[model samples]
Target: MRPVLIALPVLALAFLAGGLALTRPVTVPDTALAGLTGDAIAGEAVFWAAGCASCHAAEGATGAARLVLAGGQRFASEFGTFIAPNISMHPEQGIGAWSFADFVTAVQEGTSPEGRHYYPAFPYGAYRLAARQDLADLWAFWQTLPSADTPSAPHEIGFPFSIRRAVGAWNLLNLHDDFVVTGELTEAETRGRYLAEALAHCAECHTPRDALGGLDRRAWMAGAPNPSGSGTIPALTPDRLTWSEAEIAAYLNDGFTPDFDSAGGHMVSVIRNIAMLGDEDRLAIAAYLKALPPAGD
Candidate 1:
């Protein structure tokens, strides 16, 4: 019995070591963003598409103020409440010192500049599929945005979940770079897929999650309970949202439904950001939503 008890501790230590090795912070190559000239002008479109302002900007900020990226928004989830960090260009309080490689690593690999794993609330899982060139453009545009002195708020996670390194393991289970909508698609549909799956990260909110907090891809765009615990996010699937393609595009553009009801809640911000996109882009999103098979209740 003494020998068996001694071996149990050894086995536990071995298991922990293995887990650490498997979940080590893995970042992209340092040269991933090298040689790509950043275009701040072109990046404006990517900024809107990526919805960077939706979460990072000061809550209730409107119009031009949304570009500040002060990042005090709080997101409540089953695990805990996650706070958006300040990503402005402030030399002391924000990411002003982050290199282009740091930006790529954070967005594509979910690894922080300090080699720590970022919480999934940042939506790196969806941002991972973004085009490298577009990311470079975003970096340029980010530099052009106004800097802020706002300090980032810490997450409200508890216990073992507070350990940031543990997020490495979570990323292993949830981070997927593949396109959710596949098979042959029209040019517009393909663009829409990129916008939906990668830039806008629609599934991050629209899709349901499993027990471990990983997205349930099987359900796709079927709506889920808002992580904020308020109400269900409406499903984009044909089963629930039967809006015609034109209606969908118009709603996205004008933020008004055919019933003349105006957009409300977080969708108001989403519509504002998406409205910055070209008319064709809105139509493309409608096309992609129209093509989806019914999923989830």
Candidate 2:
């Protein structure tokens, strides 16, 4: 019993060390978006596309959380809990002192104000492809918003996971810091890619995971029980991969299926966001869906 008791901490430490050590580190690159200047109109579009109010809004806010962007929401999962941080221009806690470049890199590249890698949990992977002008404009818009003085609460992961430094390793294995990846340019394909790969950010909730906390590419967008331990979220692919693009598009746009049912779960909020986008952008997103690999499940 004495030996067992002595070995417990050693085994625990070893386990944590192994988990923490499987991290990935990356240097965020200056994206095509990094060099553009801010514009108000473009910023408003960016705000809508990124669903800026979703996380930053006060618990009850129905619209933008402009003044209330001092993060108050608590997101829980198996990994533990994360309290969204204040993002208003409050100097002490929020991004008040951050320059446009600072905010741009953070949004587009997953780098923090001074250039630390942000957890993909920030959802920058989708924001990565936002045009440079749009990113800059959003920064300008953020500057005009009223400031919040409240600081963000810290994450509640225990031990090595709580050692934010260990995130350096996680980034190396699972995170990709590059905000944009260039490819052959075509207006239609580019539009589709932008909506699916970036703005719509389809992969975040739909993608499944491995035991080590990395997404299983095998199940990319196949859907999983949201690990917060709510029951299974269900698959996006059509039942038996039978839903056509037109049906999926309709489901996304109206939240009602041709099968005479309605979309639910995480998709409810997603449909609402899509509803706000212009028809062109919405169609682009729909087009992208047709191109996604069918659920490998």
TM-score winner:
1
lDDT of each: 0.86, 0.63
1-297 in candidate 1: lDDT tens per residue? 243353443345435754669677777776755679989999999999999999999887889999999899998876678999999999788999988888899988888888988988888999999999999999999999999999999999865567666566667668886998889999998999999999999998899987667799889999989878677998999778998888999999999998999988888889989999999999999999877878844
- The alpha-carbon deviation from the true structure for residue 159 of candidate 2, after best TM-score superposition, in angstroms, is 0.9
Residue 87 in candidate 2 has what lDDT?
89
What are the models' TM-scores?
0.92, 0.76
lDDT of 2 by residue, 104-147 (tens): 67776567765465655677756766666667787877777878
Candidate 2 stretches with Cα past 4 Å from truth are 1-35, 64-67, 114-117, 177-189, 238-247, 250-254, 259-263
User: Positional deviation of 152 in candidate 2, in angstroms?
Assistant: 1.0
